[model samples]
Target: MKKQHIFQNALLTLLMLFGLAACQDREILTIENQSPAIVMDLSQEELFLDSNFPDNLALTIAWDVAKYSQPTELKYKVEASADESFEVPYVMGTVSGSQRVVSYTVGEMNKAAQTLGLTANEQGSLYFRVSSYIGEAGEYVTSTSNTTMLTITPYELEYPTFYLVGGATAAGWDAGQAIPLYKTSNMSYIYTYLTGNEPFRFLGQTNWNPLNYSIDQAGTRENYRYFKQVSSNLVQDGDENMKFTGTSGMYKISIDAATAVQSIEVEASPVAGWDFPEIYMVGSMNGWSATAPLTMAQVSPGIYEIVTPLGADAEFKFIGQKDWGDLEWGNILKDNHGYSGYVGPKGDNGNVKFVGNGGSYKVTVNLKAGTYTIVSQ
Candidate 1:
């Protein structure tokens, strides 16, 4: 009996020890090092416009609730003001939800401003601020993000309209002519235009700085100084009213015909007094080197012509240069007014015509058959 009692006490002690060990293991506490919470992210840090609101302006705001052990609901308030200090904000709106992402748009603001009888400011600035509040476990925490600034100004006006003149029945502007300008209350606006398949560079401007093409000389150039006019405004007015003409120059390009092409010709006039027109051919045939020096001979005065045998498939462009005193400049005069044509098999001849001179050579590439792409500079 004594031996049995000693064995039973040892087993009870072992069982108690095991239970204590299991309880200790269950008591272990795990602490999570939570990362910093992000409240919001503004799309742009600084937004500026010359006079009119940019047609393309969008802002995305993303936010999150405070990190906590329990579920939380986040509330957000967005406010905008004409002043950066935000002393007086126009309560734009408020949103509340579990959503982590939200977007605010200038288009919406514009509509609201219109209702308030406020014309889109030609030269106005605005700022935005967002504050977020999170309610967790009967407690509320709030966070705010840095303000973002937006500046608005009037639209700029100073682009000339490109017009098509003449050619064979196939001769017409293949590339769409007429670059429309955006309205600006001020004189400064971002200008962007597409350069057709042809390779071109900005020659000297007649009234603006020869090298930089700035309109500081608009007063002096009068009729020649092009102004930025909105597309809506330009369509109402004729191209002649713009007073801007395409640069006069000649371009030499090689056509990679899908099939055998015949009777390919390049034509252009001289810049009145300049002579010895140098034409550079750019395209896959010549590796699209705008600066690549190619030899061009004048078949006729002013009217520079060159003929080369093109394979079933080829692509190319020709650029003309003239010596103005000691400086070599683009043959803008000739290129602006010149036209190019090609005769494929079966009397299929199409002419590529000039569109505009937005400081870049623009041409319409009309093909009879097959496909071709602009190769290089």
Candidate 2:
């Protein structure tokens, strides 16, 4: 009897343990409603490249997830090739995410696609896919997101090659003449002229002012008129329709002949209506004022000229201020929108000239012996 009772008690205990474990497993299985679903949404279906960009470019992949119910981990796999089938992916990479929107860069894949002779807008395609995982006690469930495709295209940029004309290599200021803003069959071109502040007039032709002129599209080459200084509030394209708001001060610019300074000039002119103004020079070598200034004088009314002891290889720009409404303000003329020029050796003739409505100036610089690179603003 004692043995039977012990055996029965052990059996009952075993049954109870088994039942409790089964109930626990059932409760665990019912604890979570369902697994989360992840989704991906890319910003664009295609990527474009411009001539300025290399054959390979970086692409951005943005994605969004949905139905995320449980704490999940995500990983991304990008498979790309020249063929749509991706028989053999030329490029592959992995990423991880678990957020609603995840972003990834596809730079390596793009390069691999390019190596396969896949040009922009070609039939070749790149593919991307993502996988998500939800962890459980003993096992984890995985779900794969849909694949995304992107078509590559080309980008377009419109800017023409600018040319240089005349001037001394030693002098920083050289003349630039507009050869052709664009060589292609594009007719849309705008002109802008700039100048420092001062009172000066266009040289030559009394009625024809540097600030007076229009872009000529009909002619192959346009002649630029000289500039003279006169105190008048004239608006020009270089001003971007902004009125000259500067003080009246004599600013000067000096070029050193010994320094191989060939020529000194300014570019970008105000619109036609205003006269070139007078600008004086002030520098350390010139005592910092017009009175004690160097041999800074107006070569012509609008054009300030100076001869310096610096070598031809030296570089400097013309500085001055515009005189408007009794106040003197400084103005820094920009070349092709603030682009600097390449200065070369003196005695090498490469001069640039600017011939537009704003003003016509010549820059003669010797890039190499008997060789010149001229640019006109």
Candidate 3:
């Protein structure tokens, strides 16, 4: 009976241990589970940034802490885009802590405006969403808040410096007579004028000796073309120079020397009073919503320019007066809007497509010239 009593006590002890182990396992699973949801509250309905606002002033946004099924370290990102679809959103702010707030100063917001291709002094709509991430080193789960709208006017940008030279240019190879072009606040280059099928080149320095650039291929302006050759010694014997192959009229010439590989653009020159006061871009890049168009800057009279993000085989078109008015333009089913240029009516303008890969490119469109060019930067 003593032995039997001892066995019974041992069995009870084992059963108790099993019960405690089961409870501990359940607790561990509960602590590791997560279910995060975005809080709906946003700090402001309309965010205004003006020249009078202190450059250092910051725009702060607060939201409810995202919930999780288990204990988690959350990382947050504030995104802004031209459309509510958030297809090509920009990460305006990021935080990795318990805080659910994000802030951007007047300067930071202005930079973001420039990034979204917003023109100076023009009001545009921006979509905002807060993304939350939960996890440790190797694992993560993400949730996003409902998108909010912000109407803002960005300050004008400080453009870049450019000069025109070459025998085809109006100055006719005279470096002293070379025409000077204005730079956008974003630092791209532009010059507007008339040029026949003559050849022209750009001078890095205002002189003929040091750096003179020309397109490596004639009649090709859709891709990167700017090439520098101090002398015939720099290139092989048969290398070609960039020239004006399109018809001669008012022309808006654009250049992107911001990167190591330079690019060039030549489009029909806009004729003042004949063309719309403003032009905007709408297509796959911006969700193709006619209501929201990316405004183009008039670098010179009749000449409009914009730097927009493009995707692989991206397609888009120019909208006159910011709506689906009678003044729409698109590719003519030939040359792909490169040299053949574009044509239009109102409805079914078709799409101007890009065959190249994706990145932000400098696009120039000439209203009177009825021509355009998309140069990779």
Candidate 4:
């Protein structure tokens, strides 16, 4: 009887151990609510964004923490949409673990609202939702918060920045020295000289790899006659660079990045006589006289350069002709506009005030960038 009793207790102990092991296994693998209940709250009812106070707090948003089946971290992504149903969503950013609040500056909200279909000066409803993921790109599991609505009135904002880089451009394949261009909405433009027979490409950033854009990637390129594809350099997904073949002058290159595939448009600029035969410097050096004016060398297209001497505070201007016949360049300084650098083609403009010691200076004028630089050796 004693032996039977001991065996019965041992059997009970074994069953208990097996049950505990099963419980631990369930704890390790179980995931609770793959789609958790979420609620989002907004700080303000409306946002009339101002350009003056761009950094001011435009809005604050908060959301409930997502519940995970296990003790796992949750990732959150902020998404905006014009439609409450979120048929289309624009991801503003991703918030990593435990950050339940997000603050938006006037500038940030303005850009988001405009991008989400809110027009300038007109108020419209914008929907915000937070998407929660168990881990890594929402690959495992995902849940979305209830949408929050806010009436937003966005102001017009200036800009995006793009760069020009390649063998065809003046920067010449140097990504660090890539020429910068400005973009307003969809169109980015720059007026620059292109070297013939050499291929050029646009860089989305100041880096060489990954984001470089060329003719083949730009898709339906317009004014392709101005560019000839480099057939010799072509391989499958290789260097599809485009060589400039247009008339030898400055050209306006524009890209519309908003397209399905970015589109390119090139055209001859209306700027005239920028690449003239004899550009002269007749300033304080020659008593501002037209006669015996120092001749500037045409270093490149639309670019004139001269190495000359001047006196301290000696002011002078560049005339298209020897006698200043309308086309001229001078100090383009004014009330919050124009460059501290040299500019031209202005009426009754101020003479370029020489700020440095009077010595031999290499003065370079780039009509492309609409500026000039005076460098002292």
Q: Write the per-residue lDDT of candidate 3 for residues 1-377, one digit (tens) a residue.
A: 99999999999999999999999987775433244445455555565676566466556777777766666677877888888898777778777787777667877777677677676788888788887765543135467788778888877644335557765565677887665554433333332444555666666557764555555555534232454222221221223244565556545455554322345556553332325678888888888877898999988656688988787767787777667765566653323343234433344235787765677789898654344778888
Deviation (Å) of 121 in candidate 3: 2.0
> In terms of TM-score, which candidate is stronger, 1 or 4?
4
Candidate 4 lDDT, 97-215, residue by residue in tens: 67889888898888787766677888899998888876667666467788888888888756435677766676777899887764546656565666555667666679865555555
Candidates, ranked, lDDT: 4, 3, 1, 2
User: Between 1 and 2, whose lDDT is larger?
Assistant: 1
Error of 2 at 264 (Å): 58
lDDT of 1 by residue, 19-114 (tens): 999999867744332432354576655433332443455556565554533344566676666666866656666677766566655554553333
State the lDDT at 7 in candidate 4: 100
Best-performing candidate as measured by lDDT: 4
Tell me the TM-score of each prediction against the true structure: 0.25, 0.28, 0.39, 0.50
Local accuracy of candidate 2 as per-residue lDDT tens digits, 119-154:
544545666654444443213435555666777643
lDDT of each: 0.36, 0.35, 0.62, 0.68
Q: Candidate 1 — which residues are off by over 4 angstroms?
A: 1-40, 45-57, 68-70, 111-119, 134-141, 153-377
Ranking by TM-score: 4, 3, 2, 1
What residue runs in model 3 are displaced by over 4 Å at the alpha carbon? 1-43, 52-54, 134-141, 162-181, 184-253, 256-377
